[model samples]
Target: MQVNTSNDVKIYNLSAGRSQPAWISERKRRQMERADVNLRRRIQLIQDFEMPEVSQGIKVSPDGQYVMASGAYKPRMRCYDTAEMSMKFERCTDSEIVRFLILSEDYSKMICLQNDRYVEFHAQYGKYYRIRIPRFGRDMVYQPELCHLNLVGASNEVYRLNLEEGKFMESLQSSFATEINSCDINPLHQLLMTGSSNGYVEAWDPRSGKSEGVISCDIPDLISNGSGLSVTKLKFRDALNLAVGTSTGHILLYDIRSPKPYYIKDHNYSLPIKAIEFILEGDLIASMDSKILKLWERETGKPVTSIEPGTDLNDLCIVPDSGLIFMANEAPKILSYFVPSLGPAPKWCAFLDSLTEELEETAESAIYDDYKFLTADELDKLGLSDLIGTNLLRAYMHGFFVDARLYKKAKSIVEPFNYEDYRSHKIKEKLQAEQSESRVKVDKLPKVNTALAKKFLEASTNMDGKAKKKARMVDGNPLEDARFGDLFKNPAFEIDPTTEEYRLINPLVSKIEKRRKAKESHAEEEDVEKGEKEEPTELPDLEENGRRGEQEGSSDSSDDDREWVAERRKVHRTIRDEEYMERQTRRARKLLMVDPNRRGKVTEVETGTVPLISGRGVNKANVKPLGARLDEEEKQRGGAEEVQLAGGNRQMTFSLQSKGYERGREASAKHAMERKSVHRSSRGIGTKIKKPWKGKK
Candidate 1:
């Protein structure tokens, strides 16, 4: 998904085992003479095969018998037989090829991805079939056990298709935040690993179709510095180790056992890495633009060497058995490099000492700069007799050694020291430190006692002897005066006449005021003697009142009437009678349970009077019954003894209709009101005439 913006990316058609040109051969020969002897002896320019079309991918068959090459601008996938080192057959596709792979255990057929949308399987006999995908696929991997080719699309969606049937079976949603750029399958672990353009590498379980782990490849500094790196290529060394190439030309090798990458290699050109692979167990090889190839040792993560193969390349592949590196480039040719078999040499070395020596002969000449024989007497004089045959002396002389054991003796300022010496040294250091501190000058400021400070400064000044003598002369004066003798006679202060203390009072009244008071008192007595007329009071039932008056003997005197007026006023100022009526009704309703025949006959008194005790005056005879028909009561009882209801003290209200049965009666009435139309026969035979009514005169 990452475009090569630094330079135009061109593909080439590649062929292997082809002879190189004369100029190329001469160049290789000249370089060999200058190369180190070990490299010169083992490395050789094997062959180069040139074609017309640009190659997009180059891969060796699983059996290693054929080398297949496909081009981005060409329709044919060419295969070269390793035995003959010549083109065997060409399977042509409808679209230009982008990548090609040989299906495992099916060498007779090969799969080609063209234009990122068409996937074609080409047979050896030149017949092929292709499945057109909906979107552009960035990378793909074949799962042998599942018989599905997992393709990663530009939108980060992964599609799994049955390779034989070429039908989409399932799609695993993207596990990354960006488009997938590269993908690989770990056959041993059965895990699918995908790399994205945003530097995320995620591992997925194909069987469960779930993401297992994820790793971000972008280094913090690179992204922070605005040089975000994208994953350009991914190669799995095995089930446990993975090699990743980034757009920033960084090679990262990750081990499944750890969260971080185990090895990393950075490049100077900052070109996108085209391919990455584990060539020989521990050595890694990576390729970039301008045919730049680099080799690194896995143990040290150090580059062994780098070379430019005289042209820009598209991709790289390695033949494991032959130790040959094949590169597809823009020159319409595949370049091959035969790696030297020599062990790595020191990077800075010539042919003379390119390889390190196995062992060294340790003798007097090799140990010391100059050799000399020392006598036992001379050794004793120099204090060297004790170390004459020991390795300590030998190591001190030799600048370099292969089989010498070296150690450093503990260093000390004093040859030997005891506890007393240590204590004395410490005391000396402390005294020195104290003396140094004492020599330092510190500024001091004057101090004042704030607590004793006076709240106010006195204005007094010291008096001279002359001022003190003058102060004694003005002591006592004014012995007496005429006004001072008369001060008591004239009242010390005159009281204001408006004050109550100076006011005069008299109780006598004049004749006019006394006459006015007598007339007013006389008028008040006359008004009391002539009182206003009173209104007459009438009872609700005059006949009943008359009968009660006869039985109770008209006991309504002025005192009793006044008492009733006061009691009525007191009752009006208190809580209303309605407050206790409901409670009293509930209590009296309980009395109705004692007489079953008293149900529905309860009535309330108008005056809210209830007789607490039988025959008491509290049961006033003037009270009127509420909510009961007097005529109906008269008919029921035949004017006999008044059968008062058991719960008759409660106030009542009346309505014409029954409340609890209204809904049922209305529903029944609605049903009875329903009528159906009946058609009468048009013939007169079905009609009957009505007869006239006879007068009852």
Candidate 2:
């Protein structure tokens, strides 16, 4: 194995000895500053708790004092106290809880709908009672004033359970064609509403069990050319306002008095919405699907923000009037998200604000978090080779690190110019300019300039005389007005050079006078120099002879001949002797005539030619000609040639009338006719008899 001698690991000094480079410290400082700013601008996860199993449902209690969730693995329910931030109690049920509700604000009583068509009730300590319904329950809501518990499930009916009587009451039959999916009760008016799988929300009077009105939740634009949509969730902010979530990831807010929706919001995931709630006093609406959670404006339907938890979301509950939201998902832990802009943190977690503020003031991200460190060679691949020595690259150990934004900017700068984009941009600008220029503009004179306007009108009406011309001149030139006559008069004050103030101001006047005199003297000297002539210098005799020789050499030559000689001299000066000779040889070979049909065949005229200067020291006479060598090789091979037949058979044929041809043919015939005799050895094994040698001996 080969060992690496180069030190690839960097050692940083821990003590304050100034061992690190200045840029490293500077980069660290800048990263710390950036992280501090980002902390204050984004949402943060403050705390979390692990559950025994995957949480199926989660919700904050009505009094905002505790969080309750139900999960599997013996099918238990766990409640966490928000103030203490710990589990208050856990109770195991006979089956898994599909949905649950906290009936009392003091966390004394709770109701859970199990998957086995059973309704389980619990007090502050443990399980109190259980009741099995007719069908599997999907959702439930409790009305405090009527003391009635309403549950909707897989059937087209709403089952009512009176908590005061502790028994099942008369069930309300929904007139929907499909199964009921969700239901809600209006807080102010106590009106019952049930959402069906057929995309209809039916509001009923609970006292009479009669349908009051039906609202169609299907959006034609969303459901066009698609299957029918189902209502997954329904929330009522007050007596009149209602929010409906559909299977196609749409949230429709409506005023119950009108048939149309007030505004429509889409989750954009195309998944069934699991939960919808009105937070921040009904100003913002939060909707969730299995994929994403979104908070958007209720009045305008503009999206506020969204978060993807990278897991399947089961349910989410917002703390009463606050921004804190607790989510139950497929994971074993519940997640909480805080949106500071929506509302303040709950009083139980008020310390979170101070903790985040401290982090914003002191915490820092990693030094190379958002920067890409690259060497000079790596930068060349990105076309940033020209920026190696520039300040845009921060110098690190043996390379440089640039901000992500700066890297993108530099890469774009070095990119080739896009001529098509430039041309199109210019064309668009030209069109806009042409449209602007063709548009007519109306300019109105100020009402305060009535006198000037009157003069202008009079000048236009009387344009046939000198009086009119005078008026026109007065109207065109504002300075010709009588009120501006004093403005053009000369000032009364004049500078007196004999005074002390003038002397002080003009202190540099003597220097200016000296410069003028020197300039005049310099001009006179230049004129004197122009009038004189200098004597010529004599050339050396050798240089004169060389010049005369060049003149005589070109005197007898024509222009073309002279140009050819000069070009040849330039060529000789540029190339070595060997290269020049090779080029001349190539040119001479090209000039020779040859037949294309004779390709790969040697001709008599092209045989036995020796180069004048072969690098090897072999004598030219010792090198045999090509034809002579071929004849000698044929004699050594017994003048016989093998010809391949079409079916891969080989046939040997003798050459005609060649020296040693008869002897080679006889030897080949003898070898083909000779046969070895098979004999039995002493051990009774068969063996081949050895043939006698056919050599001279």
Candidate 3:
């Protein structure tokens, strides 16, 4: 014998009625007030009533006074008053409630079809009567006018039980070989509608026990896999409209007169649909799979709304004429959802409408709720380090929050490498490199002297015979052409005396000398402007005869004067020759330096060995000096003669000596003599001479 145990049963009272006792504690009162406020919110989960085990089914009575739910562990049904929203009573049964129906508004009479193929009837007090059926019942429906209970299960026939007679009655038999999964009765015509495992929905008349019509549902076309077309639920809005839920997560509505479905809705998850019902006076149809709850328009086949519960959903029932829906799931608690747009809250929770209004006015949703925040390191790992400072990532306190879609896209892009793309990119780079190398490139021209080129062009175009003759006459040279005359004649082509180029070439003329010359010129101009005049002094004159006699008497003094004049002439000549030689040497050095092959190969030649004539044979005023002869010789030799150094590849020159050349030559000669002496000593030390026979000597 099995002992009845109620130890595991639990009851929770979640009501927040306005009528509270004065003796209630402050905390309890505050809690009730908070619950009342939450219930007023538009669309929210208002209640979570726990059960002993997973709830099988839940429903609100026709009068909307109480909600009844059946569960396992104790195989009991609990009824919660709608006004108080608390468990009013619990009824324990021998078998678990598989499917249940409330017969009256008071919920005093209920018919529970158990999983053990038992049909149980209970009154307000307890289980009144129980009977066994041939097959396990999957679903059941009741007809009050006939006092009959119709059930369908694994068998091809639906079992009927007469409640008033309290005995078994004739079963409704279907001609199809498929087992019936669910059954419902049409209210207007009182015709029985049954959905079968073979995707057939058939309507039958109870009086005649004959088939009225049949719908194939074409389950293979509705699902991609083309399997599991067994209808799991059937709900009727009236005599003509019927809703069917299939095992393939499809909800099909049909008109009993037509075989094809009116509108078919997909739950998308493809889980077997658990329950379906028409709510709000048949304006909307509610369907549930194991994953979500969906409500859709009756006329338009568009989805009205949907809810994804935290747990797997087993059954759903919408409160009569209200948006509030109670859901039984694979958890100990029954979840309730409210949709304000579908309908208002029930009268018991009338404050929900006002609370939703207040919430809409004040509630603020967080902007980052849809974003995922990551730090710098995490971003680097995702190859999104470049987005650190970009607008795609919004900066929070320590990291950034990027849009979820963007993050997903970035992760996908950075995760894998395509070898084809890499190969193509490398090939493109190689082609570009080859093209760059093979393509001919031209050097950019240096900036042009526009004025000079233009003048040359103009002169060449307009040259006349007279201009050519005049240019030739100026120098009597072939290079003195009229087209090239401007190059020599134009002051713009000449180097300015005050410029750095002129100063570098003429190192003898110091800046102080230039300044002194400028001052002298300025003073002379001032004198000329002032019209200054100066008095001239008259020179004393001596007779020719008297000067001759004086010279004869003072011969020594005359000789001294002649010697002084000769010395002055010699010194002046030396200075002029040195300057000319220096200029020639510089020109030669520059020429040798420009030739790459003869660079650093030069020798200095002293041209000062020629004796000076003391103004004896040559006319002092008319004859050109030796310096002029040297200048012409240098020009004829093309600046200087090439001379190789004594050592291999050494730089030497045969150009004329410059200033400080004598000191450099003396130092080099001294170094050479010392080196020669050192070499002789080293040779002497390394060798030995032997004397014959006279060792002592």
lDDT of 3 by residue, 1-697 (tens): 0011122311111121123323346786577667765324323223335466688789888888888898866788888886776688887788788899999877888888899999887888887878889998888999888898888999899888887887778877888737998888888879988889988888888887788888887656776885657788888887678888888888888887888887888888878888887775548787888888777778886666677655788888878777667788776667665566667778988876655434432222223333677888889888888877777777765788787788878777876676887899999999998676444332321123334444434443344558757655443232335765555566566545554445344433343455556776898798897787555476546587689878885895566557556655665666677779999999987875663323233534333434545666864422545566556545654556556667665434455454487889999999999998877345765457765686675
Q: All candidates' lDDT scores? A: 0.58, 0.70, 0.70
lDDT of 2 by residue, 649-686 (tens): 33333334654777899998777667323433476333
Off by over 4 Å in 2: 1-48, 360-697
Q: How well does candidate 1 score on lDDT at residue 19?
A: 25
- Is candidate 1 or 3 superior in TM-score? 3
Sorted by TM-score (best first), the order is: 3, 2, 1
List pairs with backbone clashes in candidate 2.
none
lDDT of 2 at 28: 69
Worst 10 residues of 1 by lDDT: 451-460
- Residue pairs clashing, model 3: 40-352, 600-651, 601-652, 602-652, 602-653, 603-652, 603-653, 603-654
